[model samples]
Target chain A: MASYKELPKTAQIRLVSSHEEVYEPCDDSFALVDALLADRTKLLEHRPMLCMEIGCGSGYVITSLALILGQEGSGVNYIATDINPHAVRVTHETLEAHGVSAELIVTDIASGLEKRLAGLVDVMIVNPPYVPTPEDEVGAEGITASWAGGENGRSVIDRILPIADRLLSEKGWLYMVTLTANNPSEICLEMKKKGYASKIVVQRSTEEENLHIIKFWRDFDNEVDEINNQSTFMGSLLSQIPPFSFWRGNNGNDSDKNKC
Target chain B: MRLLTHNMLSSNIRGVVNGFPLRIEAGKVVEKNVEINGDFLKNMFVKIDWKAFVEASQSMGYTELPEEADSSMLDSDEFLNRFHHALLELHLEEGALVCPETGRRFPVSKGIPNMLLHEDEV
Candidate 1:
């Protein structure tokens, strides 16, 4: 059987460093990586020159991406940013242990990079602070900043969408994790207004939350940007997305939990 | 951070019209050898701000990159190697990226640049 070198590798949990204040890779993080794994073939073919991650907590998803795409002279560049300084250090250690590297930066939603990297990022991934909490809790110090997503868990996601639209090239693709409470359908409609198409790549539910890993790409074919048709578009998009029941594991279990 | 990262960063304080090419103040510079890919360098050539890249490299004590570069130089093996070194190899282990317009200093420690703006600037 094909094994070892023939299979793509991911960061080992044993080697992944952690800090008390940093958000460790959790269910959402695993769900995001699983989505990346599902789209591995397309990503390799995309051959993105620059791939970036916003809120790269514990470095799991970004490091996993580097490994999935291969490392030696693959010509892919990676950049990751986090608002938390401790998260940056932990991510650095995790990448080092895995023999992968990214230009790690401490920034709030790519603040300093917009002018230079405008319309340049080919691939962007974000597992934002998606847990609904008080608005004041959003962007708080330490681990709270990692999960205190304000009001419908969209304070951060709303901010990122515009930045992603501005930074992404015409061919750019974005992968993001969203919770049901975050009103993902509404988010997709928001992106449709920006002339991007969305697809649900993976859907999983835990006891506490149901997560959907959504992928978005600039769709010139989807030029139906008339504001009046948003409800109709949202209705059609929701229908096309497979119900969570259909995606449940063969034994009716959540497969993602095993990986965690 | 490497010069490549420096080339892609600016002091983004609010109302700052010009933040491109944040001047580098090198405190500690280190080099970590990495395999270079010619195709990647060629692709990056078109996107990089050449003047900013060269000056950032010079700040890190890398003077090999020519003051001017065009896609034509990609064919030269010598030029590619120098370009690769200056772009990816040299790291500003400890430094600050100073804003061109506001003159605000964003510190870089352990090769990670802190580019988050202060509340007033934001």
Candidate 2:
């Protein structure tokens, strides 16, 4: 277990731009970035060659990843995707404002990128649409795609998992945000079957939702003892670990005050 | 729209394959000074198609890059700076990203590419 070390700096909310239809940086975004910050030391040591963000609304999470991983002369390539053209536009503006650049694409999560990027991405991050809503509401043309997670909020999330598995390199690491209502344990189990070891980097409960930032990586040892390691991994993941409130005390910033 | 962005885009129109490395036809181009980051440029170099990048940069009126650069050149300060400049600073402010396979043109206005495809294409 790594100790929580404060980042040298995180993304400045004021520097993050917004659109009425695009989802702004809120608790989920902050917590996803917070998870990255908590694991920053490891990430810096990992020295990922390529980093990508799926559904990069406002480019907040990806920007924070760039800022968090932006060290002295480090070589990291960033690419972000979103279904909404408006979100892609906002993300482009936000990334420019922060002096970081990424290959921004407007698509459904890595749709056109499969052939080129398969098994090449070393670090992938997502703050997916995990809010459970009516099935029909999911994947709507506008801002609704940002949060309309239908049928246990797992629709978009489920779609992303297989794609992430395909894109992640042998040493890849994926950090994603999920709501408790989404049955995160089941998610972990599914990944474990794919031979990925998992850990909960950050778990926070706001006034409304219980959010979990889960990190998964390839582990051959765990795979060999699948039945045994799976149970233990599931036990520790769901029970032994304590969920901490990341936003408990800090009067963080303008981005922190934002909800939705 | 910088060359870096152009390098990752592809035409998503239905039935179109190999939409990668879109051909650039620029009506206007903008150059803004960005800090030269050697390490960043070196990493991007591996993934970007050198031929496509060189041709795109030339069409946009940038002629500093060589027709080919060996990895050894990554260590040269002069070469790295120019590589950094061409990739990051040169922007395709107004242009159309022409699909290599289908010949569809996605227009750029104010530096943002309009990638929205028609319903039939989707």
Top candidate, metric lDDT: 1
Best by DockQ: 1
> Which 10-residue span in candidate 2 chain A carries the lowest summed lDDT?
A249-258
User: Could you report the DockQ of all the candidates, in the order they appear?
Assistant: 0.79, 0.28
Candidate 2 residues lying further than 4 Å off, grouped into runs, are: A1-7, A71-73, A96-99, A223-228, A240-259, B72-78
Error of 1 at A144 (Å): 0.7
Q: Candidate 1 lDDT (Cα, whole model)?
A: 0.86
lDDT (10s digit) by residue, model 1, range A1-260: 56776876777789899999888888889888899989989999998888999999899999999888865389988999999999999999999999999999999989989878988888899999876666887898887788877786789999999999999988999999987777788888899889988999888877767888999999886585556666777788788554333222223232321222
**Candidate 1 chain B, run of 10 with poorest lDDT:** B2-11
Tens-place lDDT digits, model 2, residues B32-102: 77656676777767878888889888989989999998888998999888887778778887878898998
Judge candidate 2 at residue A109 and give its lDDT: 84
RMSD of each: 4.9, 6.1
Q: Write the per-residue lDDT of candidate 2 for residues A175-244, one digit (tens) a residue.
A: 9998777788888889988889888898887776678899999997767899867667767777933443
Cα distance off (Å), candidate 1, residue B61: 0.7
